[model samples]
Target: MVAPDERIGPAQTGALRLRLSLFYAGFFAFLGVQQPFWPVWLASHGLGATEIGVILALSIGIKMFSAPLAAHGADRSGQRRRSILVLVAGSLAAFCLFALTNGFWPILLISVLFYALWPPVMSLTESLTIMAVQRASLDYGRTRLWGSTSFIVVALLSGQVLVWLPPSAILWLSLACVAATAAACLFLPDIRTERSPLHRGLPIVQALRIRALSLSLAACGLIQGSHAVYYAFGTLHWQAKGYSENVIGVLWAEGVLAEIVLFAYGGRVTRHLGSVGLITLAGIAAVVRWLGTGLTDSLAAVVVLQALHAFSFGAAHLGAMACIGETVPASLSATAQSLYSGLVWGAGLGLMLLASGWLYHGLGGSAYLAMAAVALAGTFVALRLSALTPRLPQP
Candidate 1:
């Protein structure tokens, strides 16, 4: 893969957007199935809660290093789509190993390899989407909304499917998504970005010298990282509080539904408020969301408050993307995306998740107080980011 000297025409852009959308839809559709239900499958295999938690934590922790390594290779090769295909294939093979083994150690070893390759796909794909967004003058939120939509669809549908099928069927369902994503990659436009002399083929450390890039990444990561407690224990907490399984599921679905609405109108939201303001809104909403979550036992209130996930996750992410678009150079795009994924989502959230288990054990719903504080700090960081905007000039 080599970077082109000039941007392509719209006819190509339109086609690439559809293919990219399909790729995201297929990939995240699998995530929708995997995240919530994989544990159920693990439990069905007789893995204890401790074993399951360790496996999940290990899988997430591995990505802090693995994703960045994978992104570095993709950037060096300038072949993001090709990198994704390899990861999908490698992960699928690992999943097969998981299927053949029921023992704890075998499953753990295979899971490590599987997760190391798989998590990088999104960071790498985001880089591709960013490049395409730059070349095509597209809307990132609108395009990414398709992935969220697919996530919701698969999550709901797979729940029903799981009721009818055996637990072991999850691996096959995951494989189908991997295969579909690989096929979609085949249709991706064969495009690469030319190296910028400004970047001077420098390392990621040098890329971080840009204050806006680093600050924005940190802020967005914290905002995203704040979701750790909610993701890990939200269902169990609700269940213990006497909410039925179906109701707890709706609470989860409500958040995603709100996120979809936010993304669907994301362009309008960004245009009305601007990027910095949008991120600030996300931070403030997160504060309220988590605090309310900690304090409330009112089901009606939780339902309404769950809508705040839209601002918390969606707007904070769009703000980060906007910052990267305006501040980071195209040459450093892949590095920046991976940094957000590896550091923010992978390492930062992984640590928070570990803490959440302890907190949930000790304080139950009051565990959310810590998450609220986390979001509050992130809110302040986003405000700082708003004040420090710097654009990267084309070389």
Candidate 2:
């Protein structure tokens, strides 16, 4: 029998793709529930806006340290699946602690443990998926779109469920999702790359020396981080506007539905636009989307703006993955992926979450205008990035 880490043939490729797709479905189902409603659960505990902000920001911020450490170890060990299993198992254990807590401080402590372990799973999975894309000639977007599909389904279902159940029901729903993720991890392919050489100092530090990669990371960070206000409070904002939970769920699902379309045609889009072009497009879309969101609460207008999530999120994400896969060596792939997630989602978004609480509390829906400015800054960075890396990655 061939080694698990060896190059997969056609027979194995089919099975590998199936297993990876299942993992994405299970994992993102958890996010579908948590992303839109977790704030409601926190609010139900009587924590004010500032307290919720601190909890969310601190949880994300901790990833800056924890993600790098976990990925670095994964890189050194060259055991992607084992590392993922361990992380997901720990995440499940930490998330369960929510059942035992009620107050801000106690919940905050558990959130630190949960968020720390939960996000690195995405980074590592990205590394594995990209490897599959290269070796098996799989379409990265199509395979990954399974996650978005599951996300939308679960979001819609949970929305209906929340209509009947109390906010605390979110806790139970999320627990089941987390357990499903851990169970799914057990079936993931063990497609390990060669261990990264540690004698060369930190891989991420070395990665910083590549000008194109550095600029790409910065550009992606700003663009993705611009979603802070929306992610943290979009549901709550709509709730205050008198929209039902079901409608709010539909709005969230609508955005990801557009994202799914983009991912389904990812390869063709990448070929036409390239990585730099995609990021440029994303920045532009974000500027318009946030501005429109800030200006109007009309259902029609909100629906139109939400569609821009395809470019702002889906394109930016594909562009970043292409940049990493093209620029980084296989040995350093896990480290590079982790660095992107840690810095962009972890630190960049964490800071924005901190500011978003203040922004939302003070300005309400108008807080989206601030996010528009953030996207505008990212557009400038991406434009400059286009000049530095004239020949961009097409993956």
Candidate 3:
């Protein structure tokens, strides 16, 4: 097995793992508040549904191009940590501008700026964490579970907070959390090592030529993008269907709770099922989840379906990370990670969210049927991914 070396003692590795976990936990808790609530806030500020969609889509869309650019700069300079810190500082400024703006154009411009700075953080953090795991030989699952746990906690609590506070409070809370992330970044150890001149630019053509890799990326994108309907309008849909905000919170929390469990046991799971198997299973789960969500209006049914997010999102993501860690060279790790984030989360999700807005407005509850179809396509691609490459021993 091609496993990370365990040369560093457990004591040292354990401490670093704790630090990495804390950083991501705090960071994503901020996102947990933002993603679900930001659009609601925009609507509250008198942006129509179409306008709100445009702003959100624009915010995420720019990441497709910007993330690779950021990764290229980091790789070329061999200053990943410095690059992250600079972007975080830039993100803080963008948020400040957002706070001061009310006009559509200004808000849109700030959103683009904010997202441009935002995309690099996750990719760089993943690169740094993977490097740390390799250096200290720590279990990635154990180290990463804290993030999932934190997200659930913040998401549940923020739901109640929204009931008591104005929607704008979400923005302020997000800013505070980002500030904390910046502080955490200051403490993060600089982990950049030798640079490869050969890995300087985006390997667009080369990566696209890898049939298995390309298929996996495409499948993952579609499967993950299938969440656009739910992510953008799930709460509003439930609200319209007469579910209380608290119940909506519980539904969302259920999904993250499942994700936490998945991350907790991720290492063992990956050890038993290879990355391709995991991703394929996730695609299958997504098909079921989206279909079930579309077919039922029952709160219990929705909650049950949301729990499948463990496989649909958690397992699929772990599988993708494992693939990148195993197949992509260390020098190209940031770029590969960024490509995943940019292509899947940025472009794919952005486009799906836009389509979802139209569908939700036009077809109402049945919009999820489209999401299910998307998941089915992803499932087919995932099955194909298994055949494209030889199975490797699990980590």
Top candidate on TM-score is: 1
Q: lDDT of each prediction vs. the true structure?
A: 0.80, 0.86, 0.79
Off by over 4 Å in 2: 1-6, 43-49, 233-249, 296-299, 360-366, 393-395
lDDT of 1 at 44: 83
- Lowest summed lDDT across 10 adjacent residues in model 2 is found at 1-10
Clashes of each: 2, 0, 0
lDDT of 2 by residue, 88-188 (tens): 99999999999999988998888888988988897898888887777776678888999999998998789889999999999999999999989988988
**Tens digits of per-residue lDDT for model 3 on 1-395?**
11223245566776778767877887888877877788887876677877887886777778788878887777666667888889989988888776787756777778888888987887888877777756676677777888788777787788878899998898888888888888877766566745646644354444455566677788889999999999878988889889987788778778888988898888788878877888888888998998888789788888889999999998889888777766665666677778888888987888898799799999887898899899889889888888777786553
Q: What C-alpha root-mean-square deviation, in Å, does candidate 2 show against the real structure? A: 2.7
Judged by lDDT relative to the true structure, which candidate is superior, 1 or 2? 2
User: Residue 246, candidate 1: how far off, in angstroms?
Assistant: 2.1
- Displacement of residue 325 (Cα, Å) in model 1 is 1.9
TM-scores of the models, in the order given:
0.93, 0.90, 0.90
